[model samples]
Target: MSFPDEILIAGSGPAGLTTALSLHEAGFKVRVFEAVPEIKPLGVGLNLLPHAVRELDELGLLAPLAAAGVACHELAYFTKRGERIWGEPRGLAAGYQWPQISLYRGALQFTLLNAVKTRIGADRLHLGRQLTGFDATPGHGVRARFLNRATGHEETADGRLLIACDGIHSAARKIFYPTEGPPRWNGAVMWRGVAECDPVLDGHTMIMAGHTRVKFVCYPISSQATRPGAQQLNFIAELRYDTTELSEREDWSRAGNLADFLPQFESFRFPWLDAPAMIRAAPAVWVYPMVDRDPLPRWTHGPVTLLGDAAHAMYPIGSNGASQGILDARVLTGCLRHHRADPEAGLTRYDAIRRPATTQIILSNRQQGPEACMQLVEDRAPNGFQKLDDVVSRAELDAIAAKYKQLAGFAIQELNTRPSLASPTA
Candidate 1:
């Protein structure tokens, strides 16, 4: 079998960009097609877990990310009334080799984009080129068709392998499952925003409040705002609602009405932080129905494969959305490096390693995400915590949280002891 010289990657989000950079470093010439005319900072916040941070650090992106992102130290939970329930250490405090990061989604994406442009060269990335369809020959290679998002002109390109990193509404994914619909909405609507506010817990914290009926997760993303006493805080408020109307928006940056959401959170005034006031101050809010797709039996079809949300669009409850995508990049690059002579075997290997791992996370997010720990406390303390030990033992709670870390591949113990995947020397 002969190996093709170039690889084509569709999408330039964290997963796609990371894949491009890794392949470029492994001596593969790679090109990335992004649907947007320009890749700007678009999303609100991202929680880079320790496992993802270690990968970024090895890629030499930690310093720039640290400069722009907030190093989260702790995550705490409290009741709507204002009683503390559970708190846990994060990053180095939790004993991981790398620190946990919380930053604007745009900042992280831009940082990765800049690194890609520098190492892979600007010419390699084609912005505004939207993927429309593709053709693949088992041993020959894969050819992808794309439309210029800006000029509406169509073009075709060929490469050794084509990866669909085009995100949740992936054209490639739909081609694989033409009869399938949009992402499955889980009967919950979400309103997310980043607002300027005074510091809350620890002045450097990530907090999740409320229950399944109505919930709010808030955390600081950046602390050095020009305005005094103001920090850039990112939040997501979730409520029980039907998602039939949510599949209408084609764009993530779409606007949602406050009147439709504020009622549930209106009286959620914690002594530590006033949820309603913080939400009301947000200049813009992005509303979407919380959703996930059932894991596909496969992500590879001949020379074509999937990455990120295209493969597994899980709920954001566990903060693993971006982290899992970054993980996919690492595993995919590893397989390509090890099986250079056999691209089919490489794709199969990539699926074997990542598909099951990400599927576990997707299902975990649905059932026992980070917020589940808080739910246990809420169930025990129906009347609020007068005696914290009565509801659940601290040791027991710690064990539950630790189990999640282990499953998500971010337990401090695993990071300190686990062996690294073979780095591509190609």
Candidate 2:
């Protein structure tokens, strides 16, 4: 028999799926609504920091992540001409109990989705349902409306709480901040793609080359054996424009024109990898304007609140786009479990813990976060440095990295010892 306390989840992406899984583990009923008719592996590569990996490990997904993705060994920064500026051990190499992972964004989403379906039942996830509006009746909980895309009819579902994990264009968020316009652009556009290629440095390294304006990010996401010794390489080509206006809204499926950004990166040839050859190898490319919303003063309004991108959408810098969303899911779940008697209090507490944290990330990413080193190198030694120390010291580089890890809640020492976020231990 279904109870009146069932949780209603809007959006079935990683955060939403994870939310349902966590709630189910704590003996709460959850139903997820998604706008997409079919959930397929979409989007390019993303990295999971140790903090985010810890949450997934709690959900019993560490093994699957390793099977489908690469356990990143190191991360490095370089000049546009490919001169190394800074490099450091990453994931387990950096001494965290959890390993940082690099994988296709779709892979991680499905990992969480599959877990939810098996544990919460496939029927719990309602596809083609777009969240339109929601009414939260203080103590009684929420009654939400949705547009059933397949049938083209409005439907309603009542639940004890509503969590909106919808993406940046979240319908629920729009309702709360109707005066807010489209996502704010940062004058940069990214062309992302994955290709089969030989390993660059260690077969498991993530590298960011170039500076803030024009940059190239590449890493081996998986070793799925494309050829005799080839692995799938994920790369992003970013360029800053004088104008901040994005004619087309961001879409992961939008195909990019080769002539648009290839020439800018063709000259990035290095002994470790050929620049032009790798770009030409990809089957297709997707484009997105670097955009994010100003952090809202609040995320919870009675029994209805937001999570993931709907709550905090930061720039891709610092590899926290999806990682932070994963953290939000776990933290929010822990809060809800602690305040089971008063679910409204749970929503308020979650907003207090997560909103301020992600707000800092949003502002830091605008300044390039730890990636500021790339821009600094470009400023001081644009002509290429004979010695990287002359451009920036190891102490300066380490401090920048440490500060970001602390802010992002993944400093090696802290993350290794931080207590588990999932309640009932999955």
Candidate 3:
């Protein structure tokens, strides 16, 4: 049997849209299916590290992203008492060719969606189509079925390959791993919100305060949120609950009440920023469990494969979840271009390379990744220290940060020197 001309992609989020764009640039026809009836700018903020930014830059999206987001200049770690644990320049400030962008997740999604519609054509993107099941045809291609949420009708689409970018609760992944359940919660709950507030530290700095038990992370995601002097700050307040049982259903859009989690940060005020005040000032908050799926031994079965969260869902540490997914899109496009004669060989190669690479990152995030510095200081000097180095040496802090960057494939020197993931024509 000969290979089909087009590839079918499930989920029109970052990973799926990116794969569509990358594959199109590589001279392949692609179609994207999204479950939602309509797409909107509805998600909270997320950071696009330099590595991910580079890929977007190659796709000609850097200008629009910079307009919608703030370029992060530095990342800092602090104790509960406001003492600085570690600080380092990031993105272009750290000498990378690209800038680290902090932006609304929804904004980024819409940007990619528009690009897909314009370049891949609007007819190729099918919304309101929820992936139901898929089957690999022996010596042929794959057949994927989707349910129209609005009509309750089922439809089938065939392509040379099926790529699942449907997020953590992927229907395709569930079909492959029938015994595996929902994402595993690690007993920590996070309340995320965005508010217009005075910038903390430098206007471009991202900060992580406190430790594993109670933590607050804040960064300026958009300069357009308010006037020139103020910016829109995105924040997450996380606390470990005693119970192991999952209480609420896992949904990113789930609304959170301040009454439940605000008390935990009542005494979390510092000179640089008032944690409680920021929480109170925010118009809305979203609550979600800090959850991740156990890494699977394989992400490919014949001509079908997984990408992004569908492949490896890890703790949201080091800001690498979306970044890794972007990386996967590029690598998978490269594989398909190289092994066009035997598309199955390309899927196999993509699985071989990314599965292990992302597995190590999943394990590293469990150990706290770059955020480990905060935990070290909390363990050594819970009472607050006059000197940071006395609690945790600079060398120890530096090593932790560097190791995570390396694991996430964004070490400063290496990322700057790496070859472009774009095709020669791109």
Model 1: runs farther than 4 Å from truth?
A: 1-4, 242-247, 422-426
> Across residues 1-426, which tens digit of lDDT does each residue of candidate 2 receive?
232798999998878888888778877899999999999999989999999899889888899987889999999998899888888899999999989999998999888888888888999999999999987788887889999999999999999899999989999899999999899998999999999999998898899999988999999888887488789999999999999887877887889988999999888898987867888999998888899999999999998999999999889999999889888988888888888888888888889989999999999999999999999889998888788888889999998898898999998888888788755221
Estimate the TM-score of every prediction: 0.95, 0.98, 0.97
**Which residue window of length 10 is worst by lDDT in model 2?**
417-426
Quantify all predictions' global Cα lDDT against the true fold. Answer: 0.84, 0.89, 0.90
Ranking by lDDT: 3, 2, 1
- 408 Cα displacement, candidate 2 (Å): 0.3
Winner on lDDT between 2 and 3 is 3
Which pairs of residues collide in model 1?
A: none
CA RMSD of each candidate after superposition: 2.1, 1.9, 1.7
Residue lDDT tens for model 1, 1-426 = 454568999999988998888778777789999998888899898899988888888788999998888888998876656567678888877888888899999999999999998998999899999999987888778878999877788998888899999999999999999888878777888788988999886767898887765788899898878689788999888887644455474456878789988888877796788999999889999987887898988899888999999999998876889988888888788888888888768888888888998888888888757667667877777667778788878888777677778778887877877655426422
Candidate 2 residue pairs in backbone clash: none
lDDT of 3 by residue, 1-426 (tens): 454667999998899999999999889889999999998887789999999999999899999999999999999998888888889999999999999999999989989998998999999999999999988974479989999998999998999999999999999899999999878888899999998999888899999999998999999998875566888999999998887678766999999999989998988898888989999989999998999999998998997999999999899899988889999998898788788888788888888878999999999998898998999999999999887767778889889988888888898889888777654211
TM-score result, candidate 2: 0.98
